[model samples]
Target: MRAFLKKEWLEWSRTGRFLVLLLVFTVFGIMNPALAKLTPWLVEIMSESLTDMGLVASEVTVDAMDSWVQFYKNIPMALIIFVLVCSGSFTGEYEKGTFIPVVTKGLSRRKILAAKALLLYGMWTVMYGLCFGITYGYNEYFWDNSIAGHLFAAAACTWLFGVWVIGLLICFSAFAKSSSQVLLGTGGVAMGVYLLGMFPKLASFLPAKLMEGLALLQQVCEVEDYIASAVTSGLLVFLCMCMAVVCFDRKQL
Candidate 1:
C-alpha cells in the first residue's frame, strides 16, 4: 500500500493536479479575505451607478463571516475540478488497457479502488488544510476571529461532500468504459443533487446541505441541523465505495 500510494502521489505530481490544487486553494485563501474586504467597496461603486437608475443598493457589511461565505460559495468550482481529476483515475487505465497487467500480476482490484478514493480525499485534506490555515490567518488579521462554535464541524461537512464526489468518481470509473462516460455520470449526478436542493423539505436531509453549511459556520444555523445531512453524506460515500468495489470486481480487465 505504501508503494501504491507513493506511485499515485508521483503520478499526481507529474500530471500537475497537485500543483493546481495547491495554487487554486492558495489563491482562494487569499481571495476570501481580499474579497470580503473589497465587497463593501464594490457595492459602493455600483451603488452610485444604480442610484441613477432608481435602484437602491442595499447595505452590505464585510466581516469574518464573509470570508467563510467566499469559501463556501467557491466550493462548486473546486468540486467540478475534483470530479474531472478523479474521474479519469481508472477509466484511463481501463481505456488504455494499462490496468490489466496490474490485475494480472495479482494486485487486487479492490485495493486499487480504495487507494484511489482515499488518496483523492487525502489530497483534498491537504489542500483544504492549507486553504483553511491561510484564510483563518487573514480573517484574524483583517477582522475579529472570534467565530461561533462548531466551525470545524461545519467545515467537515463540506469535506465530507468532497468524499462523496470522490466515491462517485471511483464508482463511475469502475463501471464506465471511457473517461468521458465517467465524467458525465458523476457530473449528471451532481447536477441532479443541485436540482433536488431547491426543495426545502428534502434539502435538509440531503448531502447537498453539506456544501451549504456556511450558515452553520456563521452560527445562524444550529449545529444540530447538520446532523442528518452529515449522516446522509457519509452513507452515500460508503455506498459508493462499496458499489465501486463490487462493480470493479466483476468488470473484465
Candidate 2:
C-alpha cells in the first residue's frame, strides 16, 4: 500500500496536477472571505440599480457566518469540478494502454484501484486542510466570535459528501469503458438525485442533501428543521464506499 501510494503521488506530483489543485483550492478559500466582505456593497449597488427601475430594495446585512456559508457552498462545487477533471484515473490509462505494462509487471488489479483511490483521497485531504486553515485564519482576522459551534462535525459531514462522490467516481470508472462515459454515468445519477431531492418529502433521504444543506451546518442557515437530511448524507457516504469496493472487486480490469 505504501509503495503504491508513493507511486501514485509521484505520478500526480510529476504531472503538476497536485500543484494546480492546491493553487485552485487556496484561491477558493481566500475568495470566500473576500466575497463575503464585498457582498453588502454588491447588494447596495444592486439595490440602487433596481430602485431606478421602480423595484423596492430590502435591507441586507452580511456577516461572518455568510462567509462560512459561501465557503461551504463554493467548496463543494470546486470539489465536484475536481472530480470531473480527475475521472480519467483508470479509463484514460486503458484507452492509452499505459496500464498494460504496469499490470504485466505483477501489480494486482485491486491494488491498482486502491492506489488510485488513495491518491485521489490524499490530494483531496491536502486541499481541504489548506482550504480550511486559510478560511479559519482569515475568518478569525476579520470577525469576532465567528467560528460556529459544531463546525468540525459539520465540516466532517461535508467532507464525507466529497468522499461519497469519489467512491461513486471509482465505481463509475470501473463500470465504464472510458472517462467520458464514467463522467456521464456519475453525472446522470447526481442529477437524478438532485432533482428527486427537490421534493420536500424526498429531501430527508437523498444523498444530495449533503451538498445542498451545507448552509445549515455553517450556522448561515436554519436547516436544523431537517435533521434527517444530515443523517441520510452520512449513511450515503458509508454505503457508497462499500459499493465502490464491491464494484471494483467485480471489474474485469
TM-scores for every candidate against the unseen true structure? 0.89, 0.81
Q: Write the per-residue lDDT of candidate 1 for residues 2-73, one digit (tens) a residue.
A: 667777888899988888888888888888889999999999999999999999999998888888788788
What TM value does model 2 have?
0.81
lDDT of 1 at 23: 85
What do the candidate models score in CA lDDT, each in turn? 0.82, 0.74
Candidate 2 Cα outliers beyond 4 Å, as residue runs = 40-61, 145-149, 212-253
lDDT tens string, model 2, 1-253?
A: 6677787688778877787788888998999889988887888889978999999878777666777877876887788777866888778777777666767798877787778887887777778888877887787888842456556656665676677677678778876788888888878887898899889889767767666445554555554644676677667656666676677667655
- lDDT winner: 1
Residue pairs in clash, model 2: none
Whole-structure CA lDDT of model 1 = 0.82
Candidate 2 C-alpha RMSD relative to the actual structure? 3.4
TM-score of 1: 0.89
